[model samples]
Target: MNRSNTTALTQPGAPMKVRNVSKRFGAFTALDDVSLDVAAGELVCLLGPSGCGKTTLLRCIAGLERQDSGVLYLGDRDVSDLAPQARDYGILFQSYALFPNLSVEANIAYGLAGSNRDVVRKRVGEMLDLVGLSGSEKKFPGQLSGGQQQRVALARALAPAPSLLLLDEPMSALDARVREHLCTELRQLQRQLGITTLMVTHNQDEAMLMADRIAVMNNGKVEQYATPQDIYDKPATPFVAEFVGQGNWLPFQRSSDSHANVGGMSMRLAAGAGQAASGRLFCRPEAISVNPLLHEENLFPARVREITFLGNRCRMSFELNQLPGHALTAEVGSQDLPRLGAQDIFVALPPESLQVFA
Candidate 1:
């Protein structure tokens, strides 16, 4: 494939807008008043647990399933009523969905059926090269490894250069090591082509690594939509805080707009944490410092009940002396393991690391 000819197959991605979209399967509501927008050239992940309506929403946007009520727009064009073929998008599925009988080149060229023969051949070769499958063109899907087959599927999906790309757990079938490598490659390719992409995944780590923004969904509604860091560091809801990452929820009593008491130890609160009289204080295990100095404001005594070595870090579970039944988990670096002696230790919960939700 000629490098200069690649331009003919590439198009700038278009922004996608979904307004108040809802879908129902008889008595069950699949999507409920869902609304979101993806900027041109941006990649967003519709992340959630199973049966959360993420795949349904992706199907709706792809025109495979119609919403009960709502509008869908691609750039300035309303595509809600358009057919799948008319929506100007390409999709890669979890199963790789390749034709067993077709060769890699033929599969990639499948969507280019009516194009000029030479042009189709050129586009196929270009796609193969783009996906790092240049030498495997003649091999059928059955002869390729799982990762290679997925690459072929991805190449086929991008062969048409659609303005939008939809991925339904595209890397879920590959092994962990392959999935991680392909994920990085896919992100690089998406950026290079600048395709407005929406991916559906139940994996939090995958979404964090790939998406520019994440629309976290649950039970037919988007729980939160934000950048990965914000979603993890400053979750909009308790569910978002718990689901997006690992954290401990401890009971706390609000003292004022900027202070709280946890297990009788006074600690500063985040600005808006005092809205509730009492609530659960969410703190990531990694946020707590084990055996900090006694001068720390939120320092508390705890007996190390169990310690688990996790490579570079050690995970320790502590039974808080102030609250016997309650326990907090802390991740201490391997270098600090010796500092945590055989007795009770001091744990500090910094105010900035605490998120309170009523």
Candidate 2:
């Protein structure tokens, strides 16, 4: 896909749809029929591990990488072949690619240089103030810190007031402290301006904090796209459940409509009612409870393998008797911390919190 034309920037509404976009590099396929809809004033984050095609999808949307097939629409206009500059999109690179030769003010004004000089100056000043860079506009990129440089980059992108703002790892360059501060500021600024934004990030915590919806991509495909709460509570696939957080994969065989044989013990599964061959059960760390005396109906006896202290919470890994060749990782509160390297610690696996995948 090559964008030979462009669109105007002063649009009235917000909505972007990427339909059946596919791209390939040599014989290796990069994107495989990826599609997503972003609403007006909504912040959607494309999240995945490295080499999962998140960045490739973003580049396709920006028209920097042409797709082998499929169409990208900005509102109702099809921009599958439109040029990047003509799409009227504001894109911020991960490295804060600011011009080292220009001052901060000049960098912001660069985007609007085609307009009248007075109008450009006014917009630059407004953008600099918006990004909290009031008086340092005279400083060049070399004279500013990483955080300041990133702010200048953001101001420059916003100076044109593009309809859709694209952020690719905007905070990845900042330190932990600065990343936290800027993430909050970015969220606040996007909301205040009601800009439709699409961000690509590999950090799960960053996606949960910054986006209204998250699209988890893997192997050039979207595994799941949902709200933060939904993604955390109910993941669609084993990959999603495992990638989103810490969990245990318990092996079990379907024995009947309502029950299954896990290891040697008969366990009931809400989903085993169907005649499925075999499946892996998902149990979150917080859902498994330590009960010496198995009181629950489907409770199992396990020995504590290891315990890791993670500041606010403690993680307990256990080995179940019925489940062979598998270990469970559980999350416990700091106050409810169990003894380290202890054995014969009985644990209960709650059914409501259990998710299964074949």
Top-TM-score candidate index: 1
lDDT, candidates in the order shown: 0.89, 0.82
What TM-score does structure 1 among the candidates reach?
Answer: 0.96
Stretches of candidate 2 exceeding 4 Å from the true structure: 1-13, 271-275, 292-297, 338-342
- For each candidate in turn, the TM-score is 0.96, 0.91
The reply for model 1, stretches above 4 Å from the true place, is: 1-9
Q: Write the per-residue lDDT of candidate 1 for residues 176-269, one digit (tens) a residue.
A: 9999998988897788788899999999999999999999999999999999999998898887887888889988898778888777877787
Question: How far out, in Å, is residue 195 in model 2?
Answer: 1.0
lDDT of 2 at 348: 77
- lDDT: worst 10-residue window of model 1: 1-10
RMSD of each: 1.9, 5.3
Residue 85 displacement in candidate 1 (angstroms): 0.5
